[model samples]
Target chain A: MDLATAGLKTTDHDGIIRIDFIERNILDEANIQLIGEGLNHVVDAMDEPKLVICFENVEHLSSAALGVLITASNRVGSKGGQLRLSDINEQILEVFRITRLDQMFQIYDTSAEAMSAFS
Target chain B: MAESPGHHDERRDSDSSRSGVVVLHDVRTELDSLQRAVVDGIRHAGYDEASTFAVRLALEEAVANAFRHGNGEDPEKVVTVEFKISDEKVWIAVEDEGCGFDPDAVPDPTEEANLEIPSGRGIMLMRAYMTDVSIVAPGNRVEMVFRPAG
Candidate 1:
């Protein structure tokens, strides 16, 4: 499943998965659908729930997109796995802070940090 | 260019002319269809992706405001939108038929009192995304502008 049409790529490393939103755009419905669907696929393919989603190139995000992120986080959490965010741009991070979702999910400044934190 | 009241041209190519008037309509559900149409028009006019998204979101907030507050959810009324692009600037105006609102009266979203509230952020978001924003219809019309992305 395509999580975003904006050229996002997924990678698996040490049971930690990283999703990079390759192109820069707000994480709106179109891309969210892709992200959500793709995340589900990746999780299903994994034997464990340990995964970290890294929004590498994303610059802005809307509330709708955040909803999708929360949904993915919950899915990972329910399976006794972890969901993490890393490399989030400041503008998009402000939206997360404003919506108070920053408190719900663990955020890191880099992918390695997120993967290291995930257990 | 002004045409006489008696003159009518059905195929004036106004959408492409860039010289036509853009009307601003109030925010209302009845105008939801129209708002989508305007966004379609903007897309058809070849605006970039970011601009299109910004305008669409801003238009939704504006129309929702008109519906929930301005016209008091009156379905019979109408909200109008008019816009034209020229000299690398796109001007958009939205007008509602509802009682006017005070821009100053709106709570600042950044203020502590308004931070948790969802109602006050729409206009501020519009202002942040658009190059210019103004209330022209007193109680009804909102106008915004964006410079065409190079």
Candidate 2:
């Protein structure tokens, strides 16, 4: 299922799914649910064992959105897959750094670098 | 930006010259609008970008806690939010109409065992982003302050 119509764009590179946000901020509860669903769809459709979420345009993310990301990361991990985040803004990066989530996920400067890690 | 009209009661104290009060019901959907209002007020007060972001993060966490944990997501309850911004600092208080918990008892999210847990990070983020975070009025109210970085 392509969740791009649902506010998220997805691309598959050799079985590694890269999900991008069409919106700037995933702060509200409804958008969080949509992002979660998009992630779950990507995870469920994964023919390979890796998933990458790109935050290229996401500048401000609420903690509720962080909760969704955490849940998605755990879900992928439980399935013997990996989740990576790339191109996160500094402001958003500060949230991850403050919460120490930067230590949990493999972060890259760009989506290309993140995708290349799967090789 | 001027205040957006909604169901909530809003008051600005012209005498004090630097305060705004917004009382909102515990409706989850209102969080985004409330956050935007607070952030706008802070920015309009001449706060720098970093300071505004800090205040925004802290205030969001506090209100989220009031709605989620304190009010248990009950829409019938109310969350009272008051903010005062000055050249020195921004002070915000959020009160919920539900039983409150001990802030000290919240597990540290940065701990090794609690890293993957999703729930406990709100308080930690509030504390980390704000200059000071204190539970007042017998834990029913959270008061946070953010000062401009020197």
Candidate 3:
């Protein structure tokens, strides 16, 4: 099923939410703020949110976008949930590695792997 | 010449370097076009994919920092972006209208104790991706240079 919640295009995969960002470049500050708000709303609705965000469509993202993801990850952890990032291109993944966010977030090679890893 | 008020963009191509000066008062409408132009310049100058990504990411972080932190999101304030794209390297500068702050005071986001902090990573990202990054005194302006990987 497709979900229009927040700025995300998500699908339900056996209760695991597979998320894809609507924008190719997730850079704009205002847009990042909106995505963060949307994520908070989704996380609040779930008792233990298990989400897999695929970056197949994302070409460019700024540090602000990473901040939003970190905030959401903290919220999910507080609620005993899990979040996974997958399908990140090499260059974008380098951004994660540079900031050491790779250690904080679980990343997978594909969305399917990310979804399967969710418990 | 520096241009401000509404939006002004001046582009020039020469044997030395291709220069672009943009003064953006409305970030929402103007920022993306500027990025596109920069990417196009990099492509035209035959920069590799990695260099393109590095310059583009650093540019985004710098510009966003100027708009959000430096300009304080004031619509009346303008952010200025200046760039010189060359065959071997790319140089960019982003300036805001607000008074600058101390960059050293920005804690390292990668520190073990501060891993979960949601912000304060822009400067770090710029420094990581760019070959050289410097903030002009007063801290309102940042200049970065990225040389194609050899």
TM-score of each: 0.52, 0.89, 0.92
Which lDDT tens digits does candidate 2 get at residues B1-150? Answer: 132434544454454225666776644566677777767767766787777777777777788778888998787677888888766778899988887888888888889888898768888888888988889756889988888788
TM-score of chain A of 2: 0.90
DockQ of candidate model 2: 0.62
lDDT by residue (tens digit), candidate 3, A1-119: 12343468878888888878877775455477778887887788888899888899888888888988999999999999999999999888988999999999999999988987765
CAPRI verdict (incorrect, acceptable, medium, high) for model 3: medium
User: On residues A29-97, what C-alpha lDDT tens digit does candidate 2 reach at each position?
Assistant: 547777777778777766435877889877677777788888888888888888889999898899999
Q: What is the alpha-carbon lDDT for the whole of candidate 3?
A: 0.84
Candidate with maximal lDDT: 3
Output the better candidate (2/3) by TM-score.
Answer: 3
- Superposed model 1: Cα runs more than 4 Å off: A1-119, B1-36
* Model 2 misplaced regions, further than 4 Å: A1-6, B1-18
- The complex in candidate 1 yields a DockQ of 0.07
Highest TM-score, which number?
A: 3
Residues B56-144, model 3: lDDT tens digits:
88888888889889999998788889999989889999999999989999998999888899889989988988999999999999999
What is the C-alpha interface RMSD of model 2?
1.7
Per-residue C-alpha lDDT of model 1 across residues A1-114, encoded as one tens digit per residue = 554453567777866777777766535434555666776777666655777677776755654466566677766766777778888876667656655567777899999998
Error of 3 at A85 (Å): 1.0
